[model samples]
Target: MYDEILLPVAPVGEANDAITHAVGLAERYDATVHVVSAADTAVDTLAGPRTGAFSERLVDAAEERVEAVTDELEAAGVETVGSVARGDPLEVIENAIEDGADIVVMPSHTRRGIRRLLLGSVTEKVIRVASVPVVTVPMAESEAEGERSDAAVDDVGGASGSR
Candidate 1:
């Protein structure tokens, strides 16, 4: 049912759950996984403030992220390849659609109430714009329950990359 899986690696938090899910799907369907991450925000600085040149920081960060994600997928016994590009999620995903990708498996991230209201969900943008079908993995029930605690910030919600 799926061809190429586009797994987006969120900056900092990473997409551990998405990779696991993608690996399982790829194994079942014998599909290729294309781990993609759109460079919407600058991937620089560990926290707090931006440091050094934008190009240097973004490229370094994106490269590291792409390598980590690809390595994780491969380590999980799934064949994978990926690219890091800068642009809007929907635009970049649509632009990166490879020849044999019939479906786009994305881990749509949640922006929460006001942020979502103001900026809109990246998944929403991709879904509205992507030419192929998209698969979304919402936050796990267990993860959601922990949101009320101090660990709330640790749980990154949803995964919506692309295929």
Candidate 2:
């Protein structure tokens, strides 16, 4: 029941899962995938003139991210389009929805406790704001477990046991 699938890609590896999920949905519904990346360019005023250069770089990087994801999805036989926008991430994604996104399929990165509290989450914000359905594929269980295991090991104050 989806006509347009909006896949908001992160600039990091977390996007792979989201891409896989969105591509699968797109294949099933024969829908077009609109892959978008946000260039977070909101910086302090003291940064000044450097902000222009920084924004340009971020936009360029975002474009590359979208292009790469679009190419991969298209190669898999899905119709895909890409766009890069600069501003508050939530607003940029909301604008994509306004542009005609019937649904949004995005990955929810694992941010825990204080970190989650302080940084909030893009997926959460989008879900709260977007009018359309938002399908959030959280970090794969295995991946999340692995990350927790690694963190647990690191948290050990002093591991006297020899490997």
Candidate 3:
């Protein structure tokens, strides 16, 4: 039922699950995927040139994130295109949805207690505000273990090819 699927990539390990899920769903529906990497850049412009430099860094990272997902989808034979945007996370995603997303596929992390309350989820915010259907994927146990493994490897100055 999806003609245009929008998948937003987060700068975290959990995003792998969302990318995988989105690619699978897109393949099933033969839909073109619109991937977006959003960096929250609502900082005060009073920071002068430093603000511009910071925004550039965010955009660069976002582009890298988007490229990685697009490359994975392309390798899987799925049609995809992507863009990087700067704004509030929810607003950036909502703008993509309004552009032409039939549905949104995203991942949510398991946060609890004080952390969950303090940093409310972007996926939750998007779900609340998005006009289209939202598919929320949770990171699987195996994936979580893999992420831990990857982290351990990184801590010891090792490279992870899993991604």
- TM-score to native of every candidate shown: 0.71, 0.81, 0.81
Estimate, for each residue in 1-163, the C-alpha lDDT of model 3 and write its tens digit. Answer: 8989998875333345777888888889999998886665654345676867766666676677788888889999999998877666676788898899999998765656865576456778777888999988876776645645433111101111111
lDDT of predicted model 1: 0.59
lDDT of 2 by residue, 84-147 (tens): 7766677778999999999999877576787567645677878898899999877777654553
Superposed by TM-score, candidate 3 places the C-alpha of residue 70 at a distance from the truth, in angstroms, of 0.3
lDDT of each candidate versus the true structure: 0.59, 0.70, 0.69
Instruction: Give the per-residue lDDT of model 1 (tens digit) for 1-163.
Output: 8767777654334444567778888999888898766655433433544433543445456667778989888888888987777654555667766445666665544546764565455567667877777777775544333432322121221122221
Please give the range of 10 consecutive residues that has the lowest summed lDDT in model 3: 153-162
> What TM-score does structure 1 among the candidates reach?
0.71
Q: What does candidate 2 score on TM?
A: 0.81
Off by over 4 Å in 2: 12-15, 44-47, 140-163
Q: Once superposed on the true structure, which residue ranges of model 3 sit more than 4 Å away at CA?
A: 11-15, 140-163
- Whole-model lDDT, model 2: 0.70
